[model samples]
Target: MQRWKINLSVLWLGCFLVSAGMTMITPFLSLYLQEDLGVEGEHNIALWAGLIFASNFITSFFFQPLWGKLSDRYGRKMMLLRSGFGMSIVMVLMGFAAAPWQLLLLRMLNGVISGYIPAAVSLVSASTPKERMGFALGTVQSGSIAGTILGPLLGGLMADHFGYRPIFYITGGLLFLASTLSWIMVKEKFDKKAAALSAKTSMLGNLKKLMRIPQLPALFSVTFLIQFAMLSPMALIPLFVARLHGTSEDLAFWSGFVSAATGLSNMIAAPLLGKLSDRIGSFRILVICLLGAGIMFVPQAFASSVPELLVYRFLLGCFIGGLTPTVNSLIRRYTPDSSVSQAFGFNSSSLALGNMIGPITGGALSGLIGIEGIFIVSAASLLLTSLWTYRSLRRAGMGAEGRTG
Candidate 1:
């Protein structure tokens, strides 16, 4: 196999492992606090769980660009390993946490070290042929979605049989195995001397330089809005599902199914849409998917039955699946080769920023506008973003059909 192909394959697995490891422990955290850590009272468990969960993204939002700069200076592969190993160790420590604060601190540290996915993106973008970049990024994205879909199911099963703390240990072991595989199999053509020469700009200097690229800021906004819109409705889905389901029995199952439905379709659509974008141009794909996803959300808001919502969620996934890979491809297309990692790092920050704030906003809005209103707001936001992205590309003189900037 060619070196780039080999690297893509391993990095895909690395992404899967990293995403799975992060998510697997998340579903059980509340239970862990209540059962294992002996947290009493509903309010306390909720507060502790929310804080511990958001702490990771809060730190991740601030730290991703720093790692991106380091990756550009050192090597993406090294950054990936650093994140993989760092997260693995931190995850294990969570299992040993005797108190909630320990777990919160560890989660914060885990967030600070979380860069495997972005680093993998940087590596693939740096190594893959430009002609195949869309497909490669899409494939990698599918791996992450697959992990996201499977992680909760697997974690729930393990937690039932093996208990919560052991789930952390198992997640850590899986991360270690993934990193070990990358260490042995993934090869980079990175030149340290050249990277050192290119990375002399301060992190702020790099950010300023990348922002001067006309299409990039819009691309970054689209990245942020994509995540923000999707995640905003995420935490409220179970209540929405319950309202539609009209029964408590199997409510959990239906909620899980609805959540996974989007990921399942997304995993299938990402690579397919990615390949399509390579032929038709990523800019066009971005606009269409954004519109498609936005339209799909409208139907979800009106869904009267669980099955209706599930179907809508699945359709939404098909469009949402295309957004991240296309955005990443576009980011790579617009960015200078020397600052690609830094650009992706900033893009990752946008994603982390959305992840951190989306749920809070959603929860806040759920009371004022109600759950259905949140979906309308999300849909509207996406449609506006699509228009903004279209105008941004037009002003930058990128034709809708242009394959490269």
Candidate 2:
């Protein structure tokens, strides 16, 4: 096998481990707060869970660009290790948290060290051949997607059997092992002179340079909007499921199935779509996925049963799965090699911003417009984003076939 192929395989596993570790606590977070931390009331548990959940994104949003800049200077491998090991320690600490605030603070610290996925993406982007960028990224993405899909299920099971704290310890250990593997196995051919030269440029200078790239700013917006549209309906999914099923008894099982359905399809579709993008062009795939996902959301809003909603969500996932890998490929195409990590860092921040905003916006709007309205709003937002992306690509001189002008 080729060296890059080996690197990609190892990195794919590392991404899975890190992504799984990051989400393993999610399923039982509120339960942890109540049973372990002595928190009282559903309202209080919800409030604390929201705070804990958002804390990681809030800190990660501010820190991702900084880490990206550092990755460009120090090397992507270093950043990966920093995030992997740092997050492992934090996850372990969470198992020992004595209060809700303690857990929140630890989560914030995890965010400070939470650039592993983007770092891994940047590393692969920098290392892989330009022609194969989409397929490579798409393949790597499936690892993370699979991990995310499985993490909650595993966490819930472990929590039921071994309890929440033990799950945290297991997650932490897995992360540490992942970091060690990356340190030992993954290889990056770093150009120190180039890195030093890139390092001399200020973060503001890097931002300015990145913005000057045609279609990049718009691509970043696409990143934000894609995440926003996807996450907006997440919080209300269980409620929607319950409404459709008309029962509380099987709500958890059905809700979990609905949530995992998209990811399951995404895992299967991302690499295939990615290979197609490699042939046709990443930008073209981006447009198609965005528009297709928007249209998929429409049927979801009107689904008469949980099974119908599940089918719509699965289709949406097939399209949405292509969005990030294609966007990353496009970013790699437009960005200079020396500063690619920094560029990806900014892109990560855009994604984090979307994550932070999407749920809050969805929750707020759901109150006024209702749960079905959330899906409609999400569909409209995605459709508008697709238009924005099209115009931006045109202005950047990328043709309908995805060639740069």
Residue pairs that clash (backbone atoms under 3 angstroms), model 2: none
Model 2 TM-score? 0.79
* Alpha-carbon local distance difference test for all models: 0.81, 0.81
Candidate 2, which segments miss by more than 4 Å at Cα? 1-11, 26-51, 69-78, 96-101, 118-142, 159-165, 180-199, 238-254, 278-284, 302-305, 335-341, 399-405
lDDT of 1 by residue, 138-176 (tens): 789778877888776566567767777888898898899
TM-scores for every predicted model: 0.78, 0.79
Error of 2 at 158 (Å): 3.3
What digit string (tens of lDDT, one per residue) describes model 2 on residues 171-226?
Answer: 99999998998899888999878878762667788889899987789888889999
